[model samples]
Target: MYPFNCSQSTTTTCNASLYHATSLGRHDSTRQIATYYSVNETQLHPITGIHNRQDYLVTVPCSCGTVSGTTAYFHAVNYAVQQGDTFSDVSAEVYSGQVWVVGDEKQRFVAGNNVTMNLVCGCLDGKGTEEEEGEVIVTYTVEDGDTLAASLSRVVGLNELLTQNPGFIDVGWVLYVLKGSQVGCGDFEKGYFDAEGPVRYNIEEIEEATNNFDESKKIGEGGYAKVFFGILRGQEVAVKMMRSNKSKEFYAELKVLCKVHHINVVELLGYASGDDHVFLVYEYVRNGSLSDHLHDPLLRGYQPLSWSARTQIAVDAAKGIEYIHDHTKTRYVHRDIKSTNILLDDCLRAKVADFGLAKLVERSNDDELIATRLVGTPGYLPPESVKELQVTSKTDVFAFGVLLGELITGKRALVRDNKEPGRLKSLITTVSASSTHLRITLKNMDILCIKMVQPVSDLVRNLSGSSLEDQFRNWHASSLFSSYPI
Candidate 1:
């Protein structure tokens, strides 16, 4: 179906729009109504919302025209579902993995027959005028465990997130979130302003905060960095300490960290350098990590995450990964994406952390496919990353699938090693059939992930952001593999 195109000379002027679309199912938070009427993918500027100078709500444009001497703002089309059409993947080729038509729309999609679709739109008139003093309102039908913070992820931060979306959001409640090209909020509002540049701290400040690198102040540690909990101007923050002279990694990490600013991704507040040591300060997430809550809650002194929480965590982490993969100027492959790297706040909201292993993908004949030395936690890496040593965006996708399995089964990616006592077994071998709740769905999945010690590559590549929520409704998590050889 082609769009109803009109010349600029004949096109009519329509004021600020208030388009409304309903999510018919409980699992999906967002859905797209097929608008064959749009001539192209046109980006629309902010219309109704009361936005500050910095952030602008990003949206797509729609056409409006007069009919029977009355102005009508609507677009529709008739479409016959094809053979392979399904509810979430209807017939939109460009909008794959985001087709969330349900209820009557679900029936129409399943019938493989002709069905009419349209965009519902209207405007709230104020004082006899089409203008209004409000943002574009999108009404969402809340699911079982949707909190206001969950909607705030990837959209905005602290003050902006709270102010724009006030009141508690619960199941079956309607929740709204603001979106824009520059619309965002900082991690915290107390010590710093929103969208403030990363601060360059004096090394003495970090030394005093950590009490001269005292081990007692340490909160977390990794292969490359040690994390310490400290307070910065009445606000709690996590300071990661590392060696600056190690490799290109420190500079690379700073470069990558400064460029990204999304709610799902962890926020870097400032940094310091002295005596060949570097300190990176970040907003301290209250909860520990996804790995802690999932594996053994009783021993870890935490409660097991509910099924809904697991699903939400997956969605939130996916949004973070998707931001780095798609939104950044030079796309990066987060070489490390595991349950441990996903930290949670007091609200149990997930944010992706640690970009030390992240590699900037410079596409070329040699760089794109070049092999690097093996680095990453076991059980999360794929065959291409392990054997080929090739680091690409697909590597993160593979690790994420394993992380999803961890969320489902509450089992570590790698089990005890059978080949060598006190060692580890293949990651693919351990986690593939770990959960009775989930089983393999695809034949290629078995061949690639389970049958061999091989793990997920492109199996979960299609899954991202809110799509993870939609995936659980339909397919089981695919198999996983190891970064190490069997």
Candidate 2:
């Protein structure tokens, strides 16, 4: 794993203190500390710039501080290199029901000396799984000499734990137990609605809104659904109608989308269901999409987007994605994030659309990389997603990086290579092949491309991208966009 400056870590509270980590593994020589886990840099200021794990003792962030309000970090640094994970000192009191990293499932952590516990905390009291009701779903990184059995035994039975986990759990590494090992509520039961917050619109109200699905009101079309502009109770709305009878398919997507609400995310005004179709209504965004302004020839010359406008749009979109990843009642991974999906308002502010399109993880762990058929734009798809057909929050971050490249350089994620007309070059490979101090010209805007390009290029290359929260915070605070100085 690469090391980065933990100046701006991803953790929301960050109430924990610093750990001076010395890497026992090799990392990219050029890796910046900003890429992975966040830590307070004040106490143990990390050595930044031009360093590698093989050559030097690079300090890493082992700050297992706070995982939201209810929990604290359980640093499991001291373990007795045993055959299997043993009970630890922290678990002496009582604890159970926290899932480990879903990506690296069933691996033994005996060989690891300094096990890095990077738990993406998802703790919202009322939002826990219906089956897991009062029991919270927060992950705890076990400290060096702690055993969780005592606490876990009190919380849940040994038989229940064995049945849910079903196999051996590695010590030092995180072994969590969420109440249930399941997917979305809808994935199992077809017609059930979590029905937490989103409104349900009657079929007649929807018909009146779109004039009975009139072709004249059509605004968009794709494999997923058909979009129509409508007036719902005097409020202008965009209704997305998907033709399918699988109410089970609609359950998870609708439930996840309903709970998400932020200024940057496109609001799900309500939903409707017909025998053969599903309708999702959203607040209408007048300015179309960032793709329309950046890539469409018809709009580009007519109303060229200002660099100032581009930066704000990027910031707005970043915040929207970050919200779903970290701050939501249940953290979600946006399966498809692309330029067209980012809608622009009349004021040019961005509202991330198609978030409801995100598929739920097969299991409870939010950050787990669930394997499935790969679905994303060609150039925007990260290497891991393409290779493994698995997706996580990182998938969206990778796509957002491509979007950033498009904003800075006015290029599509995939472009027809001028040298080889038959081959399409990706933004990641193209930008990564460039020298550090490059310059570009766009719409009489003599853009200084060198500084801005590094961050964009790093992201497009999928270099351990920072969480949307960290990236958004860094992007807004950056002064590298010389052309669009705030």
Candidate 3:
């Protein structure tokens, strides 16, 4: 955990109160206190400079005797460590007895650098002894797209979590999370979204807006949330009314969507929560989900997307995933990257929706595999998800590869046709069952229905390969140059 300065020692006073933190100027030490979860520093590093000093504020709990308390520190010492000094070396030189240094060795203390040793108030974890909140079982249901780190971060700020649950966290494996105000919805509300006010809407206002949840007004349905088409304040809106019993997914998605904003992402306009009902209001896209346009033939008022249109849809959807993957302030993996999750606008623009299954990863550091229960749609699940329950951005990439096949072939990821006597075959299964000759498959199946161009054919060949990374890169690149004469 990163250290923060406490200007005054709690040795004199301890009272139950929220901790107050102040930013100490940055040091030449390669490490930073920004990752200290108590503070909201989502970006990897904005303090990478050799000549400038940055300020970082961190909050930590203070304990006084047997009661919870906090203290103010006005004269905290900030040490400017030279090249030869380590945290241990500095702690021994600066503080008197029983001072423990808490920084990584990889970060060398540079000359002319300043570092603050946060005075440890009696036992940070409530108890007077050194024992931290060891383990208190809190049943957090794994949301649709949650990775272990994101889930843990939700329960406890990232700093304490590293100390409590040090290694890989799995989905659906009930684990213990930190309890109390420090790691609850109250903390997230105060620290994360203090700037945005009144997220919660009135249930009565929503009911009147949606005509008392009229059947006709219902735009979409799912296990966790039912989407309604509503007009709020004279603009079209999609209101997601979550199952009152399952507030976990509601909070999970809201937490993520609140931080994320993009044209290609469904906007979370507002929300309402009460004892009996909870609702999320979003910007309503006139066209339905990609699934409705692509596969639901009975639906009216829409023409089948032309090859160019479909290609554009693919590009837009890819951009949404790219935003979630790498472009966002913090990288997120959309575990459920499938057609239904991709919604369409009136102008045929695609927006990625349903953040219920997304997980957060460090920007440019997504290769770390998170092991969890297999939870994505069957046909869209990657090989690693099924075989080892491991998840990464490539898992989304694999699912996107399936979505690409869905777009190109105009077929469901898994389906059964009476003409084919066998059971349901996934798109991958059909591709694999086809003969080694790519030309024969194209000639017979006429998948995509375009002239057999070299680039398109090569893309089809790439689908059969093992690397989802290569496949998505190839397809994303192809989507850029694709031209189909309709």
- TM-scores of all predicted structures: 0.54, 0.52, 0.50
Per residue, candidate 2 scores C-alpha lDDT tens digits across 398-477 of 77767776776566778788789999988655654452322222222112222222322232223222343343333333
Ranking of candidates on lDDT, top first: 1, 3, 2
- In model 3, the clashing pairs are 7-73, 8-73, 15-69, 144-357, 145-357, 145-358, 201-271
The worst-scoring run of ten residues by lDDT in candidate 1 lies at: 37-46
lDDT of 3 by residue, 212-254 (tens): 8999999889867889988887867888887788787787788
In order of listing, the candidates' clash counts read 8, 22, 7
The candidate with the higher TM-score, 1 or 2, is 1
**For candidate 3, which ten residues in a row score worst on lDDT?**
186-195
370-447 per-residue lDDT for model 1 (tens digits): 655898887888777778788767677768777766665566777676567798765444655554334444333432
Write the number of the candidate with greater TM-score, choosing between 2 and 3: 2
> On a 0 to 100 scale, what is the lDDT of residue 240 in model 1?
90
List ranges where model 1 is wrong by over 4 Å: 1-195, 363-369, 417-423, 433-486
Model 1 residue 76 distance off true place after TM-score fit, in angstroms: 22
- Report the error of model 2 at residue 273, Å: 1.1
| Model 1 TM-score, all chains together | 0.54
Cα deviation of 98, candidate 2, in Å: 34
